[model samples]
Target chain A: MSETPIAAPDPPPGLSELFLAFASMSLAGFGGVLPWARRAVVEQRKWLTAEQFNEAFSFSQLLPGPNIVNFSVIFGSRLRGPAGAAVALAGLLGPPLVIVTIFAMLYTRYGDIPWLQGVLSGLAAAAAGLIIATTAKMAKPLFEKALATRSLDAAPLVALAVFFAIGILRWPLPYVLAVAAPVSIALAWFRR
Target chain B: MKGDGDILLTLAGHFALLSLFAIGGANAAVPEMHRVAVELRHWMTDRQFADLFAIAQVSPGPNVIIVTLIGYQAAGLAGALVATLAMCGPTCVFAFYMGRTWERFREARWRNAIQSGLVPISIGLIAASALILALAADRNWVAGAVTFATAAFGYWTRLNPLWMFTAAGLIGLAGYI
Candidate 1:
């Protein structure tokens, strides 16, 4: 993947620039911010290669907390240090927090009307559907790996087991993860 | 009723704990959030929880803003600030440290194995989250149909999701759902 180097390189952004970049990304991101973040960091700023961005994002996704928030922290820390990380996080979340708080106030004031409730319900249904679509897209890589190998992979099985245990059975999360994470890791280690 | 300080502290503490388990993102913690908000604390009803999630989904920025909404509902603006800070703070520190060290382990076998293992589990958690949200949101046959259609559209087409969200909201406003 790294066989061919790009022809030109851009200077890495300073901390203030990083803050502005993430703040704008968050501001423009109406439904999801990850796509906007990728565009800004990889495409516009050229801070990281596309491959590097994917790696950082995947690593961030594997960690706790929100994915984009984690990405902001990781990317900022890579550029500078704790201060940069804090700056990036504040950039990404500060504006959204204010906007969402305003929304909360509006909803509380007018949420009791029947028509607004109906709209919210409809929006909720569509939002649920979007989540399902996102899940399928996220799982596609595992399914493709299993297909290419022409063998039933343990990863998909482990995933299904987790789905059934929590999604179907309604088990508490910590207990399920306590068992599933280690088992999945062991299986991968053996397979490797 | 609890004091403002007490409410803010509790909000901060609970979200900080949940932050650790947010494997695939804050969405992965929805069911647990539901349990805590609706069942345990009586902060809101199931419908209110679902509606707040929808608001977060439709709003700009990250979907985790639902935590902010929950905090707002529980203890006003102070609760919101505390919840968001708690949710993002500890995990951001972890990510910062890990990012610094991650390149050092670029070729490490154990790192690769751990990454591969966590991918599927993260996908599973997201699926569970989708299921929980779907159950909460799909209240009627029309709502169910809207959800199914939206999923199909999202999967099959590269169209912007905002269109679907707008369409659904309009449908609801028109009393279709």
Candidate 2:
């Protein structure tokens, strides 16, 4: 790819705005933020274009931290410069700390009740749908790329198969992952 | 609880394992976390795991906040602290130290291969987790409908899913399902 200059992201509304936006999304995110993140950053705020999001998202996935954190870095760096990364990271983590502490307390007390069970069961299931929809939409273009590339790539297929076996089949997932994870790492190491 | 020691050990184990596998985000390694925490250790049930995850999402910190909670629940304050440190400690050190070097290798073929591989596997694992939740969560027609419809509706349509989440919650609240 030829080097093309990146036009700087328009200055954000402010650091506070960036903080609030990230915090709001973090607090509201129930299952995961793949959907909400895309919605907020891409569509709602128009902070980044559809194409820009696609590129950033790949990096977000590849980097070590949570994709959302990686996103905050890129998004924040774009908006606020170096300091922006700090603001975004802080905002992303602040709310969840308090919320999870309280939640942990409550969970210990009333976790096994019938109604709560029903509620969470429903939520978890819906969460599944959310993941499916999110992954499908996220990967729709990638899948198309696979077809265009005219190759049945082993990576996604193996990961998918392992997940099905472990998560769906309820196989001892650790065993499966232990086997596969290292192999993939080694494959990358050798291929490198 | 059996004691603090057991909890600390569990926390240590989870931290080590999740750190190694938690490449993308806490969620990326969740299916694996579920395996170790819920299945192998039986430290928490699937529903418990899901419940913790809910707590995790609603928290103010990273997705890994659940690790702290899980640790706390498993052991106590010490557990929580240990779990938090274990999970974040290694990753943070590595991320910082290798930051420049890793960035330099960003465009390398092996990097590309690993990433390309992670994508499909992540999708599959995520799908499998979703399917598993479907089995556990869908108990009745309305519940099942909510699950499937929410997915299809969210996917095919451009409607925000939170609205559907509320709609489903109301259905449950009404005692209809």
True contacts kept of each: 0.80, 0.44
- Choose the strongest candidate by TM-score: 1
TM-score of model number 1, chain B: 0.93
* Superposition-based RMSD of candidate 2 using all C-alpha atoms, in angstroms: 4.9
Docking class of 2: acceptable
Number of the predicted model whose lDDT against the real structure is largest: 1
The true-versus-predicted C-alpha distance at residue A76 of model 1, in Å, is 1.7
Candidate 2 lDDT, tens digit per residue, A27-129?
Answer: 7676565666778777998877777677666766776645666667666665676677667766776677666766777778887776766666566556556
TM, every model: 0.93, 0.74
Worst 10-residue lDDT window, candidate 1 chain B? B98-107
Against the true structure, what is model 1's DockQ?
Answer: 0.69
lDDT, candidate 2, B1-177, per-residue tens: 556687697678777656655654776566666666776777777667766664564444556677778776777668777877677655544443443244446578777776755665566656666666566566677777877887887789987656766666666656655
